[model samples]
Target: MGTWIIDAIATRHDRSGFSCGQPSLDEFLQTRVSQYQRRNLGQTFVAVPQGEDANNHRVIGYYTLAASAVAFQNLPLVRSRRLPKHPVPVVLLARLAVDRAHQRKGLGEGLLLDALQRTQAIATELGIYAVEVDAIDDSVAAFYTRYGFAPLLDQPRHLFLPIETIDRAIDAAS
Candidate 1:
């Protein structure tokens, strides 16, 4: 097992080995981190490292969270009926990727739980309605589903976990 530390992308040094061995993701991270650093729309991108060392600080995985808007009409049936007929402030869980080397060691789950906990804390302060994510593929969608995320619509790969639901889960876990 390894210790995983979650921190802002701004504080972390740029390391090439952080790539999950995927050419597209590597290119995207390389290009976006350079071109869009600190943009409000790009604030969600975050990097996770294995430990304190910068040189050998293998990037196990990363995720992004940002302020987003969601229409009530597009939400899941259970959630839509409960919310007001207006746009809601949402924490967008944009992208989550784990390196191939760290895939099965629960690092991905740790990153997700960290994001959820952070979202919960932020929601407490800023009054967000839910944590929303757009899954990159069916497999990713299924992973979120297992964690209680529900689809908003029939397509476009969007899903959400209401803050209340998260609260309930936390309570249940305790």
Candidate 2:
């Protein structure tokens, strides 16, 4: 509602103008997004630039979410001991990117908050225990940590935030 109208990626979202400064991410959107969605590998939500004519709504950013799991062994001892000996169900925040033109203007945070809200809502019906993200770098990891994500003891780049934390944050904001 700021400058974006977020929605599931559609054929008419004007996909040609996105470039997030990451070649892989840019290429993924340019070529792989549709195939991945068709194969059910992931679901991408794109943020289209609002205020433009209906026929020219440009995509400024996007994020992907998908069902995923974390092996019990990967969890911290304190956490792993409390759960049954099995993989924990989680929602994966697979990819998130903002176009270069939209970077440094809070679009990344907006995308992340949207992803967190969606994961929190979907978990109640889907039985997810947590929302997980694999950070692309140290800076990305730090960003998630600031948002209350805990790093995996075995894998620093992998982070998680429990559903309870999401609930608390929403409650606090409300």
Top candidate by lDDT? 2
How does each model score on TM-score?
Answer: 0.85, 0.95
How well does model 1 score by local distance difference test?
0.75
For each candidate, what is the lDDT?
Answer: 0.75, 0.88
lDDT of 1 by residue, 1-174 (tens): 246776667535554666665676666565675455556565544445555577544456777777898887887676777678998789998778877877878887877887888888888789899899988779888999999998887565798888989888877877
Model 2 — which ten-residue stretch has the worst lDDT?
48-57
lDDT of 2 by residue, 17-50 (tens): 7898888899999889999999999999999877
The total number of steric clashes, by the backbone 3 Å criterion, in model 2 comes to 0
C-alpha lDDT of residue 2 in model 2: 68
Give candidate 1 regions above 4 Å deviation.
Answer: 21-24, 44-56, 154-156
Following a full C-alpha superposition, what root-mean-square deviation does model 1 have from the true structure?
Answer: 2.5
